[model samples]
Target: MKSHIYITRHGESQWNVECKVQGITDTPLTSKGIEQAHELAKKIKESGIKIDEILHSPLSRAADTAKIIAEENGLPLTLEPRLVEQNFGEYEGHEWKKYPGVFHEAKKQFACDYNGGESMLRLGQRIYNLLDELKVRSEKENKTFLLVTHGGIARMIHSYFNSETNEEFSSTNTGNCEIKEYVF
Candidate 1:
């Protein structure tokens, strides 16, 4: 049996509003972020889709969003460390503009590491491994899942399914609380 995977980025974090890079740094969600999570829950409930489980990154922003969705849908929530955002290392908490060169390098090379941070290739592998595990589990149990994660993870997931080039993968982006579907 194939399972339908619904993936979503966490709502805007306090750092997002402040225009700071969050990369593994924890922050509370802004008011709009909370509202966005609620809206996502409403959309899922209205669609009447059955979700067997909810998995989320350990970060507060993603965890909070998962909690809301799980409570609303009466589903269990699990923390998935692999779903966390890429660690930007020394760049974390800095203004995104300050790391333009790092971002440029990432777009050009999957192995690019931002100032001692995780390489894009490693991040991709981590997520892919998680996906592989989930795919097998879902197939055996005939289960569908909802994944709550960060923007970078969401973008990576999109690239995993849709991109053929590093540029294409780098170009992918996800808005806060946006939901994307993948069939496996």
Candidate 2:
């Protein structure tokens, strides 16, 4: 059988509950986030997709969620620094709603670095590179990987697999613990 790549966003974090922009700011998961991880694990197991390995961001929220899934599925996991969420710099910990204009403007200017954070182009380069490498490795080794990451990273992962419009790429975000698959 052909190999595939599976991607999932981490469960909700305390920052998420308070409507803060998580970016690369590490935060702990909420109680509901813990439950959601378990639920995601059950869903994956029931779907019967054999995950050969789990690659997770080192951020606590994503790491914790991936650990749960790894435990449930009896799969090994590796930390992937490239899978970490894009750093939002000045926007970190701020409510997204209040700063909609900044984000919207940043979306159009792909090179905008948010005064210190990774530019969209930079994020795309790393994410696309990671996916390209994974695709090659998956085909050569016949291994499937599950990437546990954050919402910003999730958007990039989807773009790696799909030809997304600029609008879609700018606006897309995955739900907490939502699993997405890409065939190799």
Candidate 3:
């Protein structure tokens, strides 16, 4: 690809403000989050990234952020099912403090599904596949992409682009609307 692919976590959501676990929970963005998206669009313009397409998670937080960016950049948005956050099942809506070591332990156990949620291995499969597909698409079309997704999904994308320790993968929490560039 002539240009790099980019990624960003959706702006702050209601759950994010409350510090709750929001795996696949359709949490909406707050007023400040809307402002953040607007600011992100400005930053993108200044960066001169020239993204060809904007892809976003189906979740409202990500979708809405993508809408703002796309409108500013004059690019079409695509709903990427593969970008969905890892389903945390019973952990949803609860504060992360309530879980204590649950998340850390669960992440280490790639096969564990959080009693009803998706396993890390499964999350890796979908995210890695999407990255591969994005690389091929970028090369075939000579285009760049911007992926709007959640923090959990961003961790997987980071792993796809770099070698990471288990600690790094489990501990990562991307800043809201901060853009990260990657090459294919």
**Tens digits of per-residue lDDT for model 3, 124-173:** 99999999888988988888899999988898888888898888788876
lDDT of 3 at 159: 88
Better of 1 and 2 by lDDT: 2
Clashes of 1: 0
C-alpha RMSD of each candidate structure in angstroms:
1.7, 1.3, 1.3
- How does each model score on lDDT? 0.85, 0.90, 0.89
**At residue 88, what lDDT does model 3 achieve?**
86
TM accuracy, model 1: 0.92
Instruction: Provide the TM-score for each candidate, comma-separated.
Output: 0.92, 0.95, 0.95
| Preferred candidate (lDDT higher): 2 or 3 | 2
Model 1 agreement with the true structure over 37-106: per-residue lDDT tens digits: 9999999999998899999999999999999988987889999989998997766887767666566455
Model 2 root-mean-square deviation: 1.3
lDDT of 2 at 59: 96
**Best candidate according to lDDT:** 2
Which digits, one per residue and each the tens of the lDDT, describe model 2 over residues 59-147?
A: 99999999999999899999999999999877788787777666755665788888898988999999999988998899888899999
Candidate 3 Cα lDDT to native: 0.89
Q: In model 1, which runs have C-alpha deviations exceeding 4 angstroms? A: 97-107
Clashes of each: 0, 0, 0
